[model samples]
Target: MQYKPASWLAAIPLAAMMGVCVGQAGPSQVGPDPTLPKPQRGLLPDMVIAKPAPWGDKTPTVPDGYTITAIATDLKIPRQTLILPNGDILVAEGKGGNAPNLKPKDVIAGIIKARGTSSVKGGDRLTLLRDTDGDGNYEVLTFAENLNAPYGLALVDNNLYVANQDAVVRFDYQPGQSKASGPPETVTPLPSDINHHWTKAMTASADGQYLYVGIGSNSNITERGMTAEVDRARVWRINARTGEHKSYATGLRNPTALTIQPGTDQLWAVVNERDEIGPNLVPDYLTSVQEGAFYGWPYSYWGKNVDERVRPQDPAKVATAIKPDYSLGSHVAALGVDFSNEAMGAQFADGAFVGEHGSWNRKDPVGYKVVFVPFRDGKPFGAPVDFVAGFRDKDGTTRGRPVGVTVDPKGALIVADDLSNTIWRVTPTQAAKSQQPVAAAQ
Candidate 1:
């Protein structure tokens, strides 16, 4: 037990016996056409969670001409962030999921996974940060409290929407207010029967006429039975004026983070794909979501590649499943995505930054850092580039795990590092040196 978890120890030989390809280890499994290695199941997948460590005086590394700053610290498990009209930042701080373990393997897996995370309890609140004078120094404030595991935030006109674990709530807004005037009213309720994947990523339509919610599947691969999966594994289209919602698309396993592509109404997501088949079988993806589309889930993956794990599988459904637009590599565990602009400097100005929370299912871990997936003509065209690194080291010690990435209007990237309980802001080196004060809100 001191050297390795029993399940992981048992899984080593199985992987070798199956001859799972190790060539897809690093970057080869990235981009549009990643090599899909044959799936291999074990008694349990490799459990390689990084032991949590302190950042101390160290910060995440960025490319040349850029700087990384800790804008806020000592947070309560911050998950997502939103930038207000007046330059204020609201951080959603919480984690919510209570799916009962279906087997001993799940219970063991949970214990192994907890080691790489922060020990803080979920804040269930929103923390606000403002640069009143536009000087880079931000004063932290509490914007809202007593929330039910809120994970998503959106602003359309004067209404601010918060997507909590069980519902989407709304509050009237007036830009500079540091706190909510009152309690939020529920815009619509979300399915919460068994939240194996509880994070509800959300965004507003360009015209503010509708809201899109990413509801994840109840279990990893429908182990909870297909009955528990109703209204799960798909994005929901909700009327902004009312609480009505309908399934926008299906077959996505866990659409963890969602956003509207800048300048278009197209919805895009960074999904966390299924696990335990093999280290490199299913590549997690970043894809443009269609109105009525299905990207393979339990029955198949990456277009008609059938997964025999699913029982009573629907062949027709598998036939209809479409491949994702871009692959972010298998088991990256991507949790956040945001489109970048020139404010982040010229090299990274035109793409989406994704927060890969890192992996726990492989011998050689992938994704414990933030990556930039380049785009061309509004579509992701190339392999992902690591924008921020040094989260996990060679010894498997992690000081941070990035969850949500936000592109600030002023040309900086706001990153949420849940393991460190910190919020990091990345910007151009010149901007960091300047620290120019912003005009105070009137």
Candidate 2:
């Protein structure tokens, strides 16, 4: 597949092609250091296919030994995610827009009746999990309400950290504790101005010493109208204990999901590109982040290629910026990302899974399901393969949309569906290990 360069005169393979060497880090060392807490033993809610989902044109299927079950369903606009130690999933539900329950045409009428907003308060937040069968299902859990517009979540020891619209907060969380009761503690006040709801996306480093937070640009590449500091689209590293912060990397438009690759300790981010260019022009991307490297945003894109649409107030610095590693098509709106460090059934022995939230800018929307980007030697392989599909209908209508994705303790792929308000689990087949090509497995 050929990617269109911003300038016709530009050459392809923007960077020197590195040899694709492959290796695997031991599973035991997949995540953070030993000081970090172990995986939670909380029982996850029993996720069963309640009824036939209106699977559109594509039928959703998993490996033979695995099944896709719902952890919880009927949720409001679920945004980012954090899976608790007790098997429960904490979700940041963004306020409503034109969604599955309502027709797109009727969305406008409903918005007006909502008094410009749903009765669901902007601060309303909830927890979804189950404690089924005294085991891995987090079925028996309480729903907590009244949280600021939270987007990112992390678990440190016994505490749950939440990134609200303006700050990063915490709460005491016990496996069986009821969510309706515990009081949240304010951990750190994030940089939040009213002009831009700096949707904070966060994740703790493998060692747990640092917490990385993503603060998106205030406007669509406008950089909050600041002429001096154009480095607003960036990820910050904060002392998990002290809250002292410093910029980790800059020049990202809206990096939604952040993760550190297992074993390699490499940082990766999935970003939403600037919009209003032709639907298929500006591409949404996923890339391995290098410290101190600047990814061109308002001033440029795909690495230092200036977008004529937005006149770069500072043209001198545009030529030296860095570009992305993988292009997820134009307008696919790639969001949540997870590395398959655990043996997830078998097909994904060494790779990362990403959730493309689907596209709206294009005439024909794509990316409603989860896709796998296989990696070797700490980089993306051939291309992204379809992992779990079936969100859209035959008539181009959607009944479900994927948002956040994670790998459960059982090694199953868990995906968060915002439109249907559910968590879908994809279990692997027993043959996963043996199914890998002999040489590839080695």
Candidate 3:
């Protein structure tokens, strides 16, 4: 296939091309290091993308003594998954975003990104997969149809909330129904202006009184002006009954996945931080979201590290920036997070599983697998460990890209692979007790 760049992209300065050779330390080194390096600016950000190489008969490689099998396949852009109470798995499958290309670099970047993604159209609906027998295979059924780019799923009481691109809607949900009986009712309007970062990651409070939704920044560093970012780069707290909402937390560039820690009311997020500074300057993180706290975006990152790119800098605001608890490495693009309780086995019984959808801004690509960060006393304790890998080949061709992750009713790990259009289930092998730990990729 012949690929052509936009005419304006040809006008990018030669200086932008010069920084392409600059290299940074490995991802593992940056994850645990407290001292962050100064930002590296370039005319254009490094773009070493892995082209999609669909899996024919291959499967993702898991840790030793763990078996991986496809529970559901032929999904259309399955971005997130939710395990219902009755053992049925609900998959949110859709894609919708139309941010204008305001800069010449944006046009070129878009073309490069589209090449790496699957050409399949999004389903724009949620699908339910039920494993009828004790076996691993699932019977697919359409749970809901005609959704407007639905990405987030939260069930509160008998109300199922779907965060569409423009609004949060509610549906009457029954315990064992295969489909919703009627049309959904609009709960509240979400910020759809410019529609830059469209994925709204949402979760309900344990008591089902409030819903928390993550809204991402409209631009990398507010180049389009802060006015375009109203109620964005933050998490919103909404009343489940009345749909009244307020900003819960601010300054998160992209909190792609939100979940409440079991046994605690505290909410946690897996954030995708800002990019284009350097290969390893700002690391995406997993952090406990404090109500009414600022995380620092467009101005500073990782708490008080001022990004010189934003004009009219606010030193006072940077001073109040709170650092994240754990770093997942720069540009990892972490999109899914779930805590492990009564997990698959003893090995995974005490940690969080994060699905890294992979990276495009670094010279060396990272994060095409699922990782586990051990937690003790409700806090991330050790370095992340690789739970599943081999998404990208030795030559950098991508066999799959992992998105949403959840623990099923049977205590198995379920991963959504959008690029390969499949959902993978991982279980502990019979001999898992005798195998060594798998070291995570940096």
Candidate 4:
């Protein structure tokens, strides 16, 4: 897990960054108002890259009431998943991002990050899984082929939309069909230029009239310059019916996952914050997506706390930064999130499930599992409870990395593990047999 310090790290003064703590953050770092520590710029940033480990007969550990199963294996880098109306599951498999490394540190960081990820090539297609006998076992089938690194998917009014690395494409679907009937049509093109944060996370409005796309910044703190960040780090609201798009909000560095809170039209996002200042200097968060609100990227983090490294700082923008609603801890790399439902059982019925893809840096590893953050009155509160874990062994070796999480209406949690090229289905112990009508009851 140790990495030789890059020669460029010598530029940082040891004294300025030496005193900060390098272990896991306490509870104060897990909720709203996370205690922000002083930025600790270090010589190489205490690099910890988890080497790949085999799972063999091991599986992720869920809470006592639930059991986890690998419904589909040997995928092509599954990143996100969607549950269809007819009880089918759609898997988005791909990897992208062509952001050129701005400095030597970028290259070094990239090399180290790759060590923890799946080496398989992206399928670049949508795969459908059908529970043919109304049982847990799934029959894998191809829904569509030849996609451009499809990452985010949504279905509205029989129109399936996929957020590709460069554009939003749509496919017409009919109930019970296991595959797409025709080729995908581009709804709109996205800002693909130098996609430092290539994931175009997406979600549709509850009414199915609008599609909100979360576009990330072109560089960490705009090192690529503001010109490269035009129309980046913001959510775009697209008219689902007409294909027209406009900026809905601004300054969110990398909103990795987006969802409409189960009962409300309000959009929510799990954002991945900037890094390198300190392991816990800036915390990744889950927040309500407010229209026309700026969440502060590059200039500030966690609302109004200025990051000194962003050149030509915008004090005005910093002042307008909207503080996030909840913090999910730093460098957790939450790649997936879905609001919980009745099928998840009472304890998890009113919350959101976050799939932390695990961290690639920091003195100690964090994440590598799925967690449930309870919510009341549609607002998140309390510390996150580990619902699916054991992806990282006690020795810090990476076994699997969870990406997108989806709550199946038929009573289960669908998890995408790109690190192992698998799709895991987690259901309450014996709950599926008797809880078939639970979602409707609620």
| Of 2 and 3, the candidate ranking higher by lDDT | 3
Which 10 successive residues of model 4 have the least lDDT summed? 433-442
Q: After TM-score superposition, what is the CA distance of residue 335 in candidate 1 from its true location, in Å?
A: 0.7
Q: Pick by lDDT: which candidate is best?
A: 1
lDDT of 1: 0.87
lDDT of 3 by residue, 245-332 (tens): 9999999998999999988889999999988888886899999999989999978998988999899899999999999989998888
Tens digits of per-residue lDDT for model 1 on 1-442?
2334565546546444232334236447887788887788776776676889899999999987788899899999999999998989999999899987777677667877888889999999999999889778999999999998999888999999999999999999997999999999999999988789999999999999999999999988888889999999999999987989999999999998999998999999989899888788689999999989999898899989998999988999998999899899889899999998767766676789999999887777899999988887787866677889999999888999999999998888999999999999988866433432111110
CA deviation > 4 Å runs, candidate 2: 1-59, 63-65, 96-123, 134-140, 194-198, 227-231, 437-442
Q: Sorted on lDDT, highest at the top, how do the candidates line up?
A: 1, 4, 3, 2
Expressed as tens digits, the lDDT of each residue in 325-410 for candidate 4 is 99998899999999877766766777899999987667667889999888866787677888899999867778899999999876
Q: Tell how far residue 307 is off in model 3, in angstroms.
A: 1.1
- For 163-221, candidate 2 gives per-residue lDDT tens digits of 87777877776775657456677777876553242567888888777788887776665
Question: Which regions of candidate 1 deviate over 4 angstroms?
Answer: 1-27, 430-442
Q: Cα lDDT for residue 81, model 4?
A: 94
For every model shown, what is its TM-score relative to the native structure? 0.92, 0.76, 0.94, 0.92
Q: Of the candidates numbered 2 and 3, which has the greater TM-score value?
A: 3
Candidate 2 lDDT score at position 93 = 70
